[model samples]
Target chain A: MSQQLDLLFYSLSDQTRRDILRRLTLKELTVSQIAKPYKISLAAVSKHLKVLEKAKLIGRRRDGKNHIIHAEPKTLIKIDSWIEFYKQYWNESFDQLNTYLTTVGDTKNET
Target chain B: MSQQLDLLFYSLSDQTRRDILRRLTLKELTVSQIAKPYKISLAAVSKHLKVLEKAKLIGRRRDGKNHIIHAEPKTLIKIDSWIEFYKQYWNESFDQLNTYLTTVGDTKNET
Candidate 1:
């Protein structure tokens, strides 16, 4: 699980790869179409795709001679689970802070 | 924004760092207490703390002779936002798949 997360987070750490994933969310696109907006070479775009594919964040299928890429958003659910743990902790901390502030306010009013 | 995400994701890519974040979420502890569980040297744990600190995922405060470390989960809100986009996309794709399946089911009934 940790190894999978390492790959997923590492893949998401790059701008080009994140952009590629976002584009794929819109619709599947051919490799050449995916590369068209970038100033970098097709090889560079292919490399980014490879990283995303390795992380299972995106998948590719062949259509005739072209490679079509699409986002695999289910893989991102792992990250959502991880972040949810921290969100729960964060909310707990906020509740504690609120309680403390209320106690302080009550003391001030009594004084 | 990309650079910050890069740092945040890169910091989370390692198991040790993720573990450290989880531990800190339980409660703030001194630097030495944070290092006690791992077999690695205090220096190695310190290095992991530095990476987490750089990503703003955790913070430290000096108290007398001790440096207390705590999880700064608010920084994770950025990740929540990023993941939220993918979740929405995933839901939309599932809806489209459901609609397609319904159409196919109706056609089968007609036959």
Candidate 2:
């Protein structure tokens, strides 16, 4: 699981890869179609896709003569779960700040 | 924002960095205190801290002789928001699958 998180985060670290994943989320696309928008070579795009594939963030299905790449969003739920811990800590800090502000407001009103 | 996401995700790709962030979430610690458990040299740990600092996932404050390290959980909110888009897509697919399964069940019942 730790290794998986490593791969998942590493896969998302590149802008091109993230763009490819975002596009795939809308609809499945063939390798060539996926490679079209980028100025980079097909080989470069394929390298990014391979990283995403290794992370299980995207998967490919053979469609006759083409390979269709699609987003695997379910794998993202794990990242969500991991971040939940920190989110809770952040929320607690917000609550504390809010309480402090409210007390300061009340003190000013009393003054 | 895209470049920031790249750094944030890249910072999280390593286990040591993630572990350091997790530890800081509990309480702020001096650089030496943070380096205590790891078998790696202080310089190696400092390298991980530098990555986390560059990402703004952790922050440092000077306290007399010590540099205190603390987790910046607020930075993680951005990642949560990014994952929100994919979660919606995942849920939509789940709903579609549910409708299909229900229709298949109805057909079986009629037979």
Using Cα atoms, each model's DockQ against the true complex is: 0.68, 0.79
**Candidate 1 — which pairs collide?**
none
Cα lDDT for residue B105, candidate 2 = 80
**Candidate of highest lDDT:** 2
lDDT (Cα, 0-100) at A45 in candidate 1: 92
lDDT of 1: 0.89
Interface C-alpha RMSD per candidate, 1 decimal: 1.1, 0.8
The candidate scoring highest on DockQ is: 2
Worst 10 residues of 1 chain A by lDDT: A102-111
Chain A TM-scores, per candidate, are 0.85, 0.86
How many pairs of residues in model 2 come into backbone collision? 0
iRMSD computed for candidate 2: 0.8
Which numbered prediction scores highest in TM-score against the true structure?
Answer: 2
Overlapping backbone residue pairs in candidate 1 total 0
